[model samples]
Target: MTGRIVRWGAVLGLGSVWWWAVLRLVLAPDAGALEGAVAAGGWGLSLLPVHCAPKSRAGARGVARWRHAWRSAATKASPRPRSDGGSGPS
Candidate 1:
């Protein structure tokens, strides 16, 4: 859960930076070299997660196992519904 939160945060932060850089370029046609570099860098950096994503078969299997374990743990920890659908015991 924490890993997911951090990854999503990084994606959103980098994506925002890229969008801001693009907007700057679009609004200012005469933007300088530094601005262009920032825009390019931002775009490239935003793709870092995709570039770093697991690609190997072993890596895919590891991710699947992790997901399965997490789901199993969650299922075991949650309360089950009563067959009679009562909120509480009398």
Candidate 2:
């Protein structure tokens, strides 16, 4: 279905973006390289920012909380099971 395809596309797109961000954050010395690529492609600004150093201990806590929130949200959004009464009540 079209909706299924769109959902898969969004999942794959976001996954790729996250991978690219991590690659830029870890491998590239300057985040500007990633930024320049974005600019060349006509995006006004790059999403890759230099995050080599943690801003503060609170920042780490914030990241952990955000992760937990996303996990809980995903858990809540998941579909419930259906009772099929298998094998036609055999």
Candidate 3:
């Protein structure tokens, strides 16, 4: 999932750069285009580098990092069927 997220993020980041060129230089150079470019770049492109960061990288350590830990934690907390005789969720 992280790989998928990072892939999407890369797509979005690249798209935003194209958007910047078309919006700022071609579409409307003086018609309040900065707001739209900023919006798309901020919400769509900014998160990409974080997800693409390596595990030991500083960007991957903060609270803003990916939520991969939650899955392992949840798995550990959940109960599983016993091999001897007990039955669990089916």
Candidate 4:
């Protein structure tokens, strides 16, 4: 829930940067403005990972959680096996 909110927040932040740069570029009509717009556009595109691949990110998080839960359960099921396969610690 919070993650989705944070993701959207990031999008809006970057989008604002992109739009501002474009507006400046359009209004200023100077050579330097082009460079700034290009740079800001790059920054804006950096947000695409969150916007474009939401499912993949969510799946990765789920996989991470599942792995953690599995590890904890395995450890709790029994004494962890010794590297040498002994019945008990030396």
Q: Which lDDT value does model 2 have at 27?
A: 75
lDDT of 2: 0.65
- In model 1, the clashing pairs are none
Tens digit of lDDT per residue, candidate 3, span 49-90? 654656576445555443567766777885765789766679
Q: What's each prediction's TM-score?
A: 0.44, 0.35, 0.29, 0.38
Candidate scoring better on lDDT of 2 and 4: 4
Superposition error at 2 for model 3 (Å)? 0.9
Error of 2 at 30 (Å): 0.6
lDDT of 4 at 33: 53
Model 3 regions lying over 4 Å from their true place: 28-90
Lowest-lDDT window of 10 residues in candidate 3? 58-67
- In the range 18-65, model 1's lDDT, one tens digit per residue, is 677778888988777777787999767657765455457436657778
Q: Give the worst 10-residue stretch by lDDT in candidate 2.
A: 38-47
What candidate 2 gets wrong by more than 4 Å, as runs, is 32-90
Clashing pairs in 4: none
Cα lDDT tens digits for candidate 4, 1-90: 999999999989977767767666677766385658676767766777554556676565577788999998988876767788857556
TM-score of 2: 0.35
Lowest lDDT 10-residue stretch of candidate 1: 50-59
